[model samples]
Target chain A: NAGVTQTPKFRILKIGQSMTLQCAQDMNHNYMYWYRQDPGMGLKLIYYSVGAGITDKGEVPNGYNVSRSTTEDFPLRLELAAPSQTSVYFCASRLGQGARNTEAFFGQGTRLTVV
Target chain B: AQSVSQHNHHVILSEAASLELGCNYSYGGTVNLFWYVQYPGQHLQLLLKYFSGDPLVKGIKGFEAEFIKSKFSFNLRKPSVQWSDTAEYFCAQGAGSYQLTFGKGTKLSVIP
Candidate 1:
């Protein structure tokens, strides 16, 4: 089962360019999240969705947007990419709340570079 | 705002040495703690988690953590280490909120 899948394992974008990072989960989970990992800085949340048609901004939401139109897909949009936006992005899904058994499953991650 | 803290940025140990990585969180309410490991070229995976019950929770790869409520600490430990144990470790906390606050992470390097 492809628990969580993130498309375009690697990508490069020029400054001021825009692109979308696609994420999908097959587990039918209610919660999905987008996070970026920078050197020495663990993971910073970008956006999240509690369920279909519901989304919310996370800790680090600047320069990004997200939409949850279906239960399986939650995509993050980068508007006018900047050098600071160059980081490894990860998508995760959880079955429910912060219960012990509801630990999140993460995708392989997409390494994005903005020049 | 709640936040997680991992004190060790980098740790190096020879094989079979005892290991301990400190983690602390700044949330007082009902909290759920977790430890995640990321091997080289791989996605983050759950190493262990604690919701309730015993403070000393054991997880995969002979790793375990102890939750000290008074100190707001959940420290990961292993009796012995192997070269394969080298990886980056993260500590995260989920409180009354839906999202988790992750620490900066600790990189463990176990040399043979």
Candidate 2:
């Protein structure tokens, strides 16, 4: 089972160019999240979805948008990319039982570069 | 405002040496703690987790973490080091909310 898969292992975009990072999970997890990892920095949450049709902002949600139209897919959109947005992005998901202790499974990560 | 802090930015150790990485969180309520490891060119994977029960939780790869609630610290340690253990370690906290807050991470380089 592909726990979580992210597309475009690498990407480069202009300052104003827009792109979407695709993430999908086959585990039917009710919880999904997007995070950016910077050099010497821990992963920072950008956005997350509790379930289909439910999305919310995370610690660092600026310059980004997300939608969860289905239980299996959560895509992140960068409308106007900036150099500050360049970093490795990771997609994660977990089964949401009453106890929210489920381990989050992460994707291979998308290395984005803004020129 | 919740935050996680990792004391060490980078650590180098020789094989068979003892290991310890410090992690602390600033959350006043109940929280779930976790340790995630990322080897070179590999995706992040769970090393261990602490929900409730024993304060000392054992994880894979001979790693273990102790949760000191009073101090709001969850420190990772291993009895022996191996060259294959070279990786980045992140300490995260799960609050009442489902989202997790991760620390800057400690890069562990185990020299052979």
Candidate 3:
């Protein structure tokens, strides 16, 4: 069902360059999130959206921005790329609130390299 | 701020060996716990989760996790490990908020 899809599986960015990491879900999930995974650092939250037109910052939202214009899309934008931003970024989504045995679904992850 | 800690960074075991990965969280309020596994070159997938009911939760691939509220820990365990069980395991906790806090993750290598 293409639970969640992320574009540009791999990319190399120059310092100070800007780019957007596109994420989309077809499951009509109300919760969408962006996280960066670093070695031995697990996944750090970047930004999240509860629903359309509702977005919020996460644990590590510096140098990044996000928007939720629709229920199916939540894109993360990096204004100025830095070497510290080189990591694997994952996009995830969940059905709704409440524990209810619902688990988040993650994307294939985008490997970004800032040089 | 909420945080998660995985005691073991990396573990290696032979096939048929018992497996246990320790996970602890810092939040004291009601929380939903989860275990996620990521195979080499593959996306992360749910291994198990604990919300309520029995403290022991069983998940796919013959995995199970015990939630010890007193200790603030949700540890993953498997009776017998298989070579295919080798993967990176992540522990996460979701509180009243929609965002989840994740542990650093533990990498397990099962030798056949």
DockQ of structure 3: 0.71
lDDT of 3 by residue, B7-110 (tens): 99999999999999999999998888999999998789998989889999999999999999999999999999999999999999987658588899999999
Q: Name model 2 segments beyond 4 Å from true.
A: none
- Candidate 3's docking class is medium
Which is the winner by DockQ between candidate 2 and candidate 3?
Answer: 2
User: Lowest-scoring 10 consecutive residues by lDDT in candidate 2 chain A?
Assistant: A94-103
Candidates in order have lDDT scores of 0.93, 0.94, 0.93
Expressed as tens digits, the lDDT of each residue in A1-115 for candidate 3 is: 9999999899999999999999999999899999999998899999988889999998899999999999999999999999999999999999865533468999999999999
Q: How much DockQ does model 2 earn? A: 0.78
Predict model 2's lDDT versus the native: 0.94
Which candidate's lDDT is highest?
2
Output the lDDT of residue A54, model 2: 97
- Number of backbone clashes in candidate 2: 1
Residue range B1-112, candidate 2, lDDT tens digits: 8899999999999999999999999997888999999998778999999999999999998999999999999999999999999999999988875868899999999999
Q: List the residue pairs that clash in candidate 3.
A: none
User: In candidate 1, what are the lDDT values of residues A1-115, reduced to their tens digit?
Assistant: 9899999899999999999999999998988999999999999999988889999999999999999999999999999999999999999998864343468899999999999
Model 2 error, position B72 (Å): 1.3
Assess every candidate by TM-score: 0.97, 0.97, 0.97
lDDT of each residue in B28-91, candidate 1, tens digit only: 9888899999998788999999989999999999999999999999999999999999999999
